[model samples]
Target: MTQFNEDWKSDRIGSALRGENPLVITEMSSGFAVMGDTQFLPGYCVFLPKKTVESLEALPMPERTAYLSDASLVGEAVLRATGAKRINYSIYGNTDAFLHTHIFPRYHSEPPERISRPVWDYPAEHWKSNDDSYKEEQHGLLRDKIATALTQLMEEAYLEKDV
Candidate 1:
């Protein structure tokens, strides 16, 4: 048996804060937009708070709002980049004990039963299975697509603000 560096999963927020994680797509108003390690869903991502708060309620009201807004922006980016039929937003911190929002891109091409169910219901193999892991080239392409979408959206928001 091999022991992998699960450290990335353990302290994703810390890694992002340190600028040590290549998975970070961009720094948003309230958090960092990071690509998911597993590419099963293609454009999956997470919005991680800059500070390590246990939950959204732990943040100031304004910060909480910003985090939510950032999560929404991530979902929009995933949708635009992947052409996903829908996006799933979730924020359960049972395992990681950190404040983060999962932005999952749901596709119409997904198996019918899996499409309508919670993403957690998908087989474990799809979650982090070595066989289904992302190749280097796939990671670059997906990251670029999401980053481009996020940049465009941010530009649009700025223009609107200036209008």
Candidate 2:
């Protein structure tokens, strides 16, 4: 149902592709990697497919492979940039109704009990926009670090595979 309109007004993927999304770090082979709105977990990000597809099954085998591979690249870059203990990857079309992947960085410093829980369970404060929200002025450096790491990883990966 989601479509990429030219104005990039309602579509994040469209905004990202047009170089209008300030949160976009860089464009990967399969899609665009944009910074997340919340920094509750630093280095959180999302990987969006290049095209407007409702689900993973909508993509052909090659595109699907590229999307998955690029998702992993984003996770690794986040890990390298934020020193996260591990990464969490999730893709569900329920909320957004589009093809995208969420890359969450799990830190060792997280509350012990909540560390193992899904990010959605981290309380409302983490998800709501407030004083501690993503501002380019504050989080730009971290975004750049992740972008640099991701670019390097992509180069090495695609080069090795000759893709």
> Which candidate number would show the highest TM-score if scored against the true structure?
2
- Per-residue lDDT over 1-163 for candidate 2, one digit per residue giving the tens place of the 0 to 100 score: 1332336537888888777776778898899998887888888998999998999999999999999999999999999999999999999989899998999999999999999899989889888866557677788899989989998999999899975
lDDT of each: 0.85, 0.88
Q: Give the winner by lDDT.
A: 2
What is candidate 1's lDDT per residue for 1-163, written digit by digit as tens?
1233557666788878877666789998788999887888898888999999999999999899878877888899999989999999999999878888888999989999999899999998888797656555667787888999998887787678689
- Rate residue 3 of model 2 by lDDT: 33
Model 2 alpha-carbon drift over 4 Å, by segment: 1-9
TM-score of each: 0.90, 0.92
Model 2 error, position 3 (Å) = 24
